[model samples]
Target: MNREELKALGLTDEQIDKVMAAHGKVVNSTKDKADKVEGLESQLEDYKTQLADRDTQLDDLSKQVKDNADLTAEIDRLKDENKTATADLQKKLETQAFDFALDKALTGAKVKNSKAIRGLLDMDTIKLDGETLKGLDDQLNGLKESDSYLFEQETEPTKPTIVNPGNPNGGTSTGDDDPFAAKLAKYN
Candidate 1:
């Protein structure tokens, strides 16, 4: 590998010089190839490091995308539930308003047995329209003409809910409110 080692293998000076020149060509070619390989190995390591970092970034982005999708789905579900709850609450409010209005109307009509009259009145034709009940007035008038006994007489006054569920005429046939009816019941 060195000039001194070649000189020690003693031929003539010219022959030694020629042999050293040929040996230099082969050794320099091999050294150049080894240097190029080392450079390539270092470049390969750099590329590998870059690829690993990009992979990690890609994984994080993918996880974020999945989380966003889950949140969107949850938001959609809550919106649907809210819409259903709002609709149910609106329906309940409308029903209560109608019931209150119907009670007030029956009381104003002087209905003696409210529960009895309510059963006789046709409900299918009734509808609430902005604080007014459609088709209710006509139905009430028809009932007043056909079933006049269900209302308070012109001279006598009576309570609206004068009847009970068990007995449509009144709560008791024993007539607890009248002394004559009570005496008649005792005789019977």
Candidate 2:
């Protein structure tokens, strides 16, 4: 139905004009509200994108923190292992020193011949009978140097005397009559 038909039925010209103007104003207001709602929706989408980015960044930082903690724990474990290894090595060194001291004492008791002692003795007073003897002497010396307090307790106050085991002239051999002297003479 047309506004003219409604006016013919009951309304006047002024009333019809007023009603049309009011309807136009309501339509314009609705269009303005719709525009505002669209702008707000676009802003909400932007905020959602920002929130997603922040969440991803937080996750990455959490992973990095966990990794750092793991590395720190590993370092602590390695340090503890190193400390245990050092203690074990020290104990082994002390044990070897005591055994060497006992072996030297036994060898001195068994060998009565003086020439043999002279022949075995090196310039440093360490026995050099064979590769095995030299190795034993080196091990003993290393232990002594590493543990000075133990070395002092092990070494006796009296110096050991060298005796000759061999006698070329079939006479009683002494430290002075050592036959191996000639072999070491050139090196000295």
Candidate 3:
């Protein structure tokens, strides 16, 4: 929230400053997570490139093995296994990245319960374009227009803070204040 927005909300300059500081802190925290996610995505892409290179190398090796029947058989078997394994691994990684991004977007959109929101989404329609979700914002906007209660309203004075995974006061906990546990608690 900007200073003007806070001022319009009837807060004094000092109060606005405090709120802005808190908001900035929260935003920076989110940005850090986003950066980490981006790094992971980059790494995943690199793995895909490496896999392609390995496939090329395997093809080269296979050509060299053509003179030896046993070597050719082994190379063919290895090539098939590598293709299947790489395809499965790449699919799994892509799925994970998509899920991670979707959940992050859902959180940033201030959804009250992500599991509930996910049920309303068309998985087929949602596609991940790098860090952006191609169809999610449109769907979220539609949902906000129709099912407003599914999300948290921004008008509230005190925003609910998420505890991160590292800092004791900010991260994981088995207790009530733990963000992960609290999210799980909603379902329980």
Candidate 4:
């Protein structure tokens, strides 16, 4: 209430001064409390934002760790596959080299049906040496000798014969001494 109104209501000046001082103290106290609450609310918001950022960072780190593990597993698998493939390649090369040596040896021995010879020969025991090849050659020669019927036998061509209907022995016919033509000429 206005000081004039309070005075008109028969309030003494000392009582008015006491009431005003009490109201002023209450307003100041409320303002101070509101300011403190506002500061605390601001700090709480900052903490919440920091927590969100930390959670995002943690999620990113977790993903990176999982990806690294997956990558390491993949690398190990690839290394194993590479080792297997390399071993297979080496084995294939060795087999090809052995086959090539066998083929060359057969060719040098002038063996027909080399594939058959290869089938008959023992791959494990066959050595790539001069004596071994000579033995193989001897075996081939023995097979050729025993199986001579396998080779083509060429025969001598027969002489061609000439036949003449006019003469039994290809002699010329004597039309000049024909007795039938002489009779026909007399009739004409």
The candidate scoring highest on TM-score is 3
RMSD in angstroms between candidate 4 and the native structure over all alpha carbons: 54.0
What candidate 4 gets wrong by more than 4 Å, as runs, is: 1-67, 127-188
lDDT of 3 by residue, 78-174 (tens): 8888888798888889888898889899988989889999999999999999988999999999999999999988875664344546665554455
TM-score of each: 0.46, 0.29, 0.53, 0.36
Tell me which residue pairs clash in candidate 2.
Answer: 114-163, 114-164, 114-165, 115-163, 115-164, 115-165, 116-165
Hey, what RMSD does candidate 3 come out at?
20.7
Q: Comparing 1 and 4 by TM-score, which wins? A: 1
- The Cα error of candidate 4 at residue 187, in Å, is 54
Which candidate's lDDT is highest? 3
Model 3 earns a TM-score of 0.53
Candidate achieving higher lDDT, 2 or 4: 4
**lDDT, candidate 2, 1-188, per-residue tens:** 45987576566676677667867865785586567656656755665575566556555555566658876676556556655655675565444444344344424333333234334434354443422344445544554466444332433333334454785457665535466876676579
Report lDDT (Cα) of residue 94, candidate 3: 84
- Relative to the true structure, candidate 4 reaches a TM of 0.36
Model 4 per-residue lDDT tens digits across residues 63-96:
5666688766765565566566556755654554
Residue 128 deviation, candidate 2, in Å? 99
Give the range of the ten consecutive residues with the poorest summed lDDT in model 2.
Answer: 151-160
Model 4 residue pairs with clashes: none
